[model samples]
Target: MRRLLLLPLALVTLTLMTATTSAAEKDARVYEMRVYYAPPGKLDALNARFKNHTLKMFEKHGLTNVGYFVPVDNKENKLVYFISAPSKAARDKALQAMGGDADWKKAVADSEKDGKLVSKIESRFLTVTEYSPLLKVEKGAEERVFELRTYTATKGNLGHLNDRFKNHTIALFAKHGMTNLIYWNVLAGEKGADDTLIYLLAHKSKEAAAKSFDAFRKDPDWLAARKASEEKGGGSLTAEKNGVVSEFLVPTDYSPLK
Candidate 1:
């Protein structure tokens, strides 16, 4: 009789665990990052269309605008933006709906009357890391520069790279005055899923960002952690060439993040 009762309790616990895992999966959000290259003399027009029409249309179709930015020097005439959805399926559905909407069609037609504003576009899907801070922008926050950093792990060492960040690097970054904005993993089966870590950091200025990194590199704890991780992985976790890439960006005038 005791065994029968215990079996039922065990089943109940397993059921509850399954339900919790399902709920967590259901609530997970996916982020999309898109980069647009504007045609010569058309960058300002592209920005105007987004600021005036595209943003509102995105919200109308159920997409959440995360932020919009451009590089500090504007040499490439590129626009970078991020958006989020409850899931990839939801994001695709919303985009399809927006594409078919009459207003969106008209906006595109009107904006392109002179010429095509955008020359090319690149996109990637990302999911937040478990150790990342809640991705958000506080209302009325002061203006700041942002750094987008991408780390490419050496073959067979991506796990080690993630472990180092989860266990040591993030805290040390905070200790040196860098505001950890968000960390992301490229979705499975994507180009970089086997070996990439992408994250964003906010700083008071580009000069401040440089100084903060200088300090972080010299921190004894960081050096020790790097040594230990490399030893455990049997070599350097990151690739020897182009292992890390960084780009500094400034918020657009209409960006929510700034």
Candidate 2:
């Protein structure tokens, strides 16, 4: 009789655990990375609008601001930022509501009275990878330079590329003094969705980043993993030309992640 009762209790616990996990997955946020290109001298005005008006407006509508950044070199006058919502449907609803809000419209008009603040906008929706840390609202312990990396996998090799990272690369990164912040895959229906892996890493500085990568590349474990994975994937996993793109970014004053 005790065994029978134990079996039922065990089954009940298992059911509860599965249900909880499902709920957590359902509640996970989908993130959006947006890049706004400012027309020449308008970058300051664009940033001012975000600082003075837009961030609050976004919070009021249930959108969570992640971080805002500008390229370290600052050649293009681009503003890069992240935002997230509970789910894609919720994201659409919040954006629509914000778009229609009277105050939002007014703020946009006022900011752009002289000229349009942004000349071009590029947006991509990304889903967090299984190994990535859930982004928190808390800031880092120290000021850091963030590097955004975009990897384009060779045709039909994305799976193998992800396998390498999941099993070996992330650990080696930490061993070499690189802090892995978040990793993502572009959502289906988006350009590069099938071939792109985008992730962010925080470094002590550009010099630190360079030093870290140099060590990482020379690490025996990393070399073995890379060789094995490439062999399994049939040649290099990434495209031959521009396979990897890296950009160093500095956090804006109000960026939560910094």
Candidate 3:
């Protein structure tokens, strides 16, 4: 009689666990990366709009603000940020809602009254790579300097590059004191789907970043893995020149995913 009762309880527990797992899967978020190219002298105005009104308006439409950044080099007047929604369908619906919001429309008009702030906007949908460390919002994460790196793979070699990172490079990065935040690939962009990898890393400071990279480059394990992959894969996975772009950034005060 006791065994019969215990069997029912165990089945109930299993059913509940299955339901929770399904809910968690349904709640997984889709990330969007956006880059705004501010016109020659309008970067400050653009930033002001986001800082003052745009972000709040985004929240009103159910888009969760992730992080905001500006390139340290500043060659182009640009702003980059991330946001997430429950799913691609949800993301599209929320963005449409935000666009139709009266307050957001007014904010855009007011902010651009002087002139149009942005000239071009580039957007990409991304999914975290299978091996990527899940990003979390943590206290004191704001103090770290972030690096956004985009790599363009050599023609037909992206698979090789991904394998190297999946099997070796990611571990080497951790060994060198670099914090790997997330790795993603462009899902919808001008960049070829099979040839691009974009990722973010964090470091304690600029000096520490330089030191960490120096050590990473010299690590014997990394060197061996890189050489073997290049030889087996026909060549280096990345282009020989101008294939990698690295930008240093800092999180905005109100960024939720610091």
Candidate 4:
């Protein structure tokens, strides 16, 4: 009699666990990548606004602040950041509400009293790829260097590129001591939707990143995969000259994803 009762309880527990896992999978988060192009002399002001007011406003409206970064090379005076929501509809509603909040309005007006700090803003909505590892904020991740890589595929070749990564590149990266944090495709942006791949990687240090990549490039498996993909596709996946961009970043002290 006791064993019969215990069996029912165990089944109930398993059912609850399965339901929770299913819900999490169905509600997988959607991410937004935002870029603010600050005017030549106004980068500092823009950063100040975000540090002081914008991030708080975002939180109040139910957006999950991921991280904030500035490019190491500083080729353009830009601020980049990420945020997440439970779904695209939720993200849209939250942003609309944040836009109308009185506190946010006052903060924006006060920040621009001198002059408009940003010349333009660009936003991209992204959904994680099926093969992407779930993103997490590690307790000591602040000490790690993050690299954001963007790849532009040649016309009509994005699917092939993704296939290669899905089957080959990701494993090769792990073999070389690289951590694949997340992978995404641009849902909306100036760049065409079908041709872009963006992903983030974390490394212990800059030197470690270099060493890992150097090893990855020379691995026999990667070389064979690349050659076969190129041959099958009749050419390289990316455009000729400047098909890839990589930028190193450090998380801000207050960034939630660190």
Per-candidate clashes come to 0, 0, 0, 0
What are the lDDT figures for the candidates, one per model? 0.82, 0.84, 0.77, 0.79
Q: What TM-score would you give candidate 3 relative to the actual structure?
A: 0.83
> Candidate 4 versus the native: TM-score?
0.83
lDDT, candidate 4, at 97: 100
Indicate the worst ten consecutive residues by lDDT in candidate 1: 1-10
For 177-212, candidate 2 gives per-residue lDDT tens digits of 787778888887888889999999999999999999
Candidate 3 clashing pairs, residues 3+ apart or interchain = none
Off by over 4 Å in 1: 1-27
Kindly list the per-residue Cα lDDT of model 1 for residues 1-258, writing each as its tens digit.
223224443353344334433443443688889999998899999999999999998899888888899988778899999988988889999999999999999999999999999999999888877666666655335668999998999989988998887667766676677777788888787889889888889998999999999999998878999999999999999988999989999888888887
Better of 1 and 3 by TM-score: 1
Which candidate, 1 or 2, would have the higher TM-score against the true structure? 2
Identify the runs in model 4 with alpha carbons over 4 angstroms from their true place.
1-27, 139-142, 188-191
**Candidates in order: C-alpha RMSD to true structure:** 9.8, 8.5, 9.6, 8.8
The lDDT leader among the candidates is 2
State which candidate has the highest TM-score.
2
| Model 3 agreement with the true structure over 127-193: per-residue lDDT tens digits | 6665566676554534788899989999988778877776677666666777777777666443567
Which is the better candidate, 1 or 3, if ranked by lDDT? 1
| Ten-residue region with minimum lDDT total, candidate 4 | 1-10
Model 3, global lDDT: 0.77
Question: TM-scores of all models?
Answer: 0.88, 0.88, 0.83, 0.83
Candidate 3 ranges beyond 4 A from true positions? 1-28, 139-142, 188-191
